[model samples]
Target: MKAPRVAVIGGGLGGLSAAALLARGGCAVTLFERSKHLGGRGQTSDVEGFRFNLGAHALYQGGAGMRVLGELGVKPAGGMPGAGSYLLSGGRLHTMPRGLVSLLTTDALGLPGKLELAKLLAGLGRVDLAPLANITTRDWVEQHLSNADARAFILALVRVMTYCADVDAMSAQSAVAQLQAKPAVLYVDGGWSTLVSELETRARDAGTRLELSARVSAVLLADTGARVRGVRLADGTEHAADAVVVAGGPGDIAALLPADALLAHDAARAVPVMAATLELGLSRLPRPDALFALGTDGPWYASVHSAVAKLAPEGGAMVHVMQYLGGRGPEASEARLEEVMDALQPGWRTSVVARRYRPSLLVSHWLPTAETGGLRGRPSVEVPHVPGLYRVGDWVGPEGLLAEASFASAESVARALVPGQQVASRRAVGR
Candidate 1:
């Protein structure tokens, strides 16, 4: 019998990981990317000694992305500064309370509020989130806490963790799970594109054929729609395969299929929570010692990326500021982010060397809605009622969020394609 031939659409992380694993398992894999380059939203651009990524991308120390990279023997380099993060509160920057000492000493919260917060954090790990799965984070906080300061503080933490500003729509269960996990984030020495580059190399090394600038017009299906035969290119070329995998969001996948294609409704209706990001490469450090910080009153986060990674040139600084727009447009959200930046880094705008603004990417992809079982109710990698067809992206269900969900879907697809084969050396989560 001949080895199974697979055709992967989209050259993002999920596609690359799946292609590499399948090819390594003795299958013939051909990865197609419509863009001239791979890495989708993870791509980076370099200009005049400065590097700007698609958005603010960070890898959690024990995240799915790192674990997957570790399986491939790729070690990312960087470290968080010892000063840790800070929060903007009451017209001042206060150190983020981590332990008993900081919680008691930090002026961000009142002593009573701090004590209450400590209890909440301590109980988050052991709390059964099942009962709270259907409630919003806002409701949960209001129900459990009496202090206004404590409520606002926890709301900010939830926004920062879930990347969703609408606390009323955010799932309490998801927030608790993430806060409990407490994943350590890292900035790669160069940029996230560096990791993408490594994944591309690994795929090619595993005998996966990657073709750039090849636009897939549509997935070719069998007579009964039971299996995907291959794909037809935009330029009228046809490539055959035993199976097909789409490494793109639901919206992207919908565009490639027929108007009445199966699962088109789900793809179209799957609403994604978006983010607005402002990245500045400065001539000097703005917040020189801080690694990360959050706004206590709103949905904003800032990080001195260069403090943790060598992202800036000598004597230069790299800062990434992001705003989670609950329902705001780019212009409005960008303005708000600028305000946060101005508040946090006074006189810092004068030192800017280069800046980029990205306002439209699915930060959390699907909204963590308790009403919808959070991510647990998301669509599966396999297209419903279709065989030999799979979808791999953040939108795919695998009990995770963001990049972690992407990695999980990729691994799941690879395992389904190559039964009994160990595609990953160890399991890891992505951010």
Candidate 2:
């Protein structure tokens, strides 16, 4: 008996993970990617001697992505910066409040503001975030703490964690859940593209055929719309498969299917957030004391990748400054990010060896919220309306952000494909 043939669309982490797992489980897998390279937005570009990623990517310790990597025996070599992160306020950089002592000692807030913040942090564990789902982060902050200082600090934290501002648009429940989860942050040693390469290798070693620059134009569905036969390529060629998994962005994937196709409605409704990233490769390091920093008053974040990862040439430094913007054009966002980077690393302009600016990158497919409404926003992996078809992506039904969410969807679909063999457990990886 021949093994079941599976077709995976998109070469991003979710698709790669599913392909690797299915292949490992004795399935004949073929993964199709439209781009010349794999990894989607998680890719790293080489300009001159500098290694710069599409954006700042930090794997949450013990999150779903790490678990998948662990299963493949791919250990990402690098740890968090020892000094952690700082917050910019009042024209000064202050130690971010990590604990009661830091909260009390930090000059970022006044005595009254500190007490209010402490109370809020203490009560965070007790709050039923589900109820706060409909509430915005701004609304939640206003209700909990009236002090402007406290509000600015908390809002900045939310932006840093979620990479989405407009607290009025952010789900309070989602914000609280993220804060409560508190996953460990880690920078991969050789950049995320290296991780993508490793995953590709694992899939190939397991006998999964990866086809790049193969644009899938459509998913072939049976007349009853109850089953997927395979996919049609842009070149008008059809490849048959027993099962099909789509890992593209929700909108892009939905466009491949007919209006009546399963999960199409949900996919169309997904709200994606845009990320603006400014990557600067310096001839020398700056702010070597800490690994991360956030602008409390401004919508910006900066991290020194070289301090934690081998993403730059020897003696050179790689820094990523990001701003999650709403409605702002890429050019405008880039200009704002440049200013933020300049502030974080004074005289960095003179030290610049190479630089790249990404005005717009879809960071999240479905905006996560604390409310029940946001829960059903993401479509599940299994397509009940269409058998032999599944979806896996950051926007798919999973309770995590970015890589974690992508892995969660991939793991769910893989487990469903091969339940008895015991695929990688969905455990968070941490130091």
Clashes of each: 7, 10
Across residues 1-431, which tens digit of lDDT does each residue of candidate 1 receive? 79999999999888898888788888999999999999987887875466787667777666667767776667878775446578876546787877788888888888889878888887877777666667887888998788887887888787766677776776777777678777777778788788789999999999999999999988888887667788999999999989899998777777766654667777665768777888888898665565567888667788777776878888888888887777332333777777777767767889989998877656755776767665555778888666788989877863556777788788888778888777554332212
Best by lDDT: 2
Score candidate 2 by lDDT: 0.79
Q: Which structure among the candidates has the greatest TM-score?
A: 1
Candidate 2 Cα deviation (angstroms), residue 217: 0.9
Span of 10 residues, lowest total lDDT, candidate 2: 422-431
The estimated TM-scores of all candidates read 0.93, 0.93
Candidate 2: regions farther than 4 A off:
82-84, 261-264, 327-331, 369-372, 424-431
Q: What is the lDDT of candidate 1?
A: 0.77
Cα lDDT computed for each candidate against the true fold: 0.77, 0.79
Kindly report which residue pairs in candidate 1 clash with one another: 63-429, 63-430, 64-428, 64-429, 64-430, 65-429, 65-430
